[model samples]
Target: MARSTYVSEFHFSREVRRLSGESPAALRRRIMLERAAWRLQRGEAVATVAADEGWSSAEVFSRAFRRSFGIPPSRVGAEFRLPAPNGLHFHPPHSLWLDGNTASADIPALMIAHDIADTGYLIGRAAELSNTQWRQPLSPNQVVLDWDGPESSVAAVLCGTVWAKEVWLASIEGRDFPSRAATDPASVDARSLAVHHDDIGAHWSAMVATMTADGRLADTVIDALCDPPESFQLYGIVAHVLTYAAHRRELVRALLSRLDVPTRPGDPLDWMRGN
Candidate 1:
C-alpha cells in the first residue's frame, strides 16, 4: 500500500489509523466476520462460512463471531450489521449502506409533498381565471372517475384533484366524507382548495411519515368507508392517491393553458428547483 500510494509505510499506517480509526488488518477482519454473520443468518453451514470467510476452523469462527456479535452464529437473526466507527454497513449482494446518511430524503413522502404543492399552485393559478373560464367545459361529458362525474372543466378537475386527498384522508382518519363548496367541483374556488389542501396535506404527510417510520406500511386497515367494507394497506392508499393526483394536475394544467392561464408543464424536477 505504501509503495502503491507513494508514501512511507509508517506514514501510511498512521494515516490509515487517523482516517478509519482501525488498523488495516483489524478492518479487514471485522468486515470478514460481519460478512460471515450475514451468510450464517442466510442458513449457510457454519463450517462452510468459516472456510469461505478465511477462518482457519469452525471453532475459531464461532469464537470470533460470538465476540463480535455477542451471539452464537446459530442464533443470528434479522440484523446482520455490527457497529463500526466509519458508519459503513455491508448491504446484501455486495453493497454498502452508510448509516447516518441524510442526503437522500424519504422518496414516497417527497412524491406526496410535491403532488400537494404542485396541485396547490395550479389551483391558485386557476383562481385567477374568470368564473366563465373556470367553468367552461374543455371536454364535454368528460369524466376522470365514473363516480366523481364529469371533470370536464378547470374548476371540476382542480377541485377533484384536491378532493381525492380529502376523501382518502377521511378514510384514514376514520371520519365522514367532507362536503360543501370544497367538495363541489363546480363550486369550489382556489381559496377553498388552498385551505383544504394545507389541512389535508398536513394530515396526509404525518400519517404516511408515521406509518413508514413505524414499519406499518404493510399493516392492513379495515376501510369501512368502502361500500360493504374493504381492507387496504397504508402504502397502497398513498400510492393510489399520488398516482391519480398526478393525472389530475396535468389535466388541470392543460385546461388552464387552453384559457391562456399561465402555468408550467408541472414537471416535478422543475417544481423542485423553483422551491
Candidate 2:
C-alpha cells in the first residue's frame, strides 16, 4: 500500500516525525533536494540532476531548490554558495577530525564516555513521561518479543551499550566477560539505569587510565569478534565500542520520540562542537 502505511506498520513514522519535525513525505522531498544541490555544486547539469532525483522537470526542480536553499540550481556552482535555512544546515561529525595534533592520547575513550553520559541525559528527560506514555506499544501492529514498550526498549538498549563495552574491555584485558547489567527492560527503572550508566562510566575511565599508562593503544593485540577469532590491534576494539555505543544511543532516542516525548537531535557532533 501507501508509503505512510508501510512506515506506520514498522512503528517508525511517528518517531521520524518527532525527531525531524517533518512527515515522511516532506523528509523525503528535503533529502532529494539536498542531494540535487550537492550534484549541482559538483558541476552536474541541472536537467540531469533534476531527472535523477525524480523531479518532473528542470523547472520544477529549480523552483524547489530555490525554495529550500534560497538560490536556484544554476547558482549553486557560482563563486559563493547560498546559506541553508537554520533547520536544514548540515553538521559533520567533529570526532572524525581528531588526530595526532588535535586530540590527546585519551581522546577516543573521552569521546565514547561523553556519548554514554549524553545518552543518560536523554534518558533522564523521560522521567516525567506519564505511565500511559511509558507503557504504550511502539508499533500498534507488531509485538517486539523482549521489549513491549518504550521504557523497556530504552532499558534494553542501555543494557546493550554496557554489555558491549564490557565485552571489549574483557578482550583488551585478556580476561573473561565480567558481569553485565540486566538486559530485561521491564526489570529496571530510570534510577537504576542511571546507576548503571555511572558504573559503566567508571569502568571506562579506569580502562582508559590503564591504556594511557601502558601506551598500548597501538601495540596491544585484541582477539576481535570474527570467524576463527582474528587478531586486531587494540585501537580496533576502541573504534568498535564507539560505533556500537552511538548506535544504541540513537535507538533509545528514537523510542523516546515514538512515546511522544520531545527530544532535541542528539547528534554527538552537536555535543562535541558545543552547539
Candidate 3:
C-alpha cells in the first residue's frame, strides 16, 4: 500500500510540473531553504537546522545551501537580513536563488507593472471593436441584462479590476475609497472605459513607485473580511491583485474571441519571456 501511494504521488508531481512548468520538488526545496534561512537567523545551530530540514548531514546541507545561494549557510544570518519597507524580510539566498544577485526589492514592482500593462493591452483590443461588435452577446445563450452580457461583462470585469486595485491602494494609504457610483456594466461605454483604464494605470504605477521607494511591501494592512477583522500583509494583497487581474484578462480574451474580434497572445509566460 505504501509503495502504491508513493507511485501515485510521483505521477501527480509529474502532472503538476507539466502544467505549471515548474517541478513540485523545486518549489518545495525553495520553501524549505527559505524556512531554514529564517531558522538560522534566529540563532539555530547549523546541524539542528539541517536535520530539521531533512538533510542527511550538515555537510550535505551546507553544500546545497552554498550552491543555491552562492554563499555557505554560516553567512546567511548576517548577509541576508535585509527587511523590506513593508515589514517583510528577505534572506540573501532568496535574491541569489531567484534573480542571480539582482536587488530583490524591484521584483514586486516589476510584476505589478507588467500585469497592469498587460491589462491595458487587453483593453486596447476591446477599444478597437466596432460598436455593434462591442455590444454583441458573448454567447447566443447569454442572458440579457446579466453581467456576462458581452458589453456589460467586459466593462464590469475591467472596472472591477480597477476598483479592486483602488481598494488595495486606499488600504495602503490609510484612506477610505473615494465615492463613485457602483460599476454598472450595462451603462459603461468604450470612451468611459478608456478613461477608467488610464486612471487605473496611472494610479497603479504611482502606487508601485511609492511602495517600492518606501520598502512597504512587507507591511501589514487590516482586512475587515474576517470576524473582528484580520491583519493581511501588503505583499499578499499584491499577489491577490495579480491573480485576479490575470483571470479577468483571460475572461476578456474569451469574450473577444466570441465576438469574432482579433485577439493577441496575452499569457503571463509570454510576458515574462518578453514576447
Specify the highest-lDDT model's number: 1
Candidate 2 wrongly placed segments (more than 4 Å): 1-110, 129-152, 220-227, 272-275
Q: Listing every candidate in turn, what is its Cα RMSD in Å to the true structure after a full C-alpha superposition?
A: 9.6, 15.3, 14.8
lDDT of 2 by residue, 9-126 (tens): 3457666677757766776676566666666777889999899889999999889888877877888843222332225422221111111434554576668667776867865865
Tens digit of lDDT per residue, candidate 3, span 1-275?
A: 32555667778778657764556676566557767878888788999999988999999999988877777888885444332222223344444333243565466666777778777787777777776666655544533224334334566666566667777777778787654453445566666766776786788778767875788878888778668998978778778888877777777788887777767777656777883
Instruction: Count backbone clashes in candidate 1.
Output: 0
Pick the winner on lDDT between candidates 1 and 2: 1
Can you list the residue pairs that collide in candidate 3?
85-215, 85-216, 86-215, 86-216, 86-218, 86-219, 88-218
Candidate 3 regions off by >4 Å?
A: 1-101, 130-152, 180-183, 224-226, 272-275
Candidate 1 local lDDT, 60-142, one digit each (tens): 99999999889989998788878788876677877777677576766797798899888888988988988788789888887
Better lDDT candidate (1, 3) = 1
Which candidate number maximizes TM-score? 1
Angstrom error of the Cα, residue 195, model 2: value is 0.4
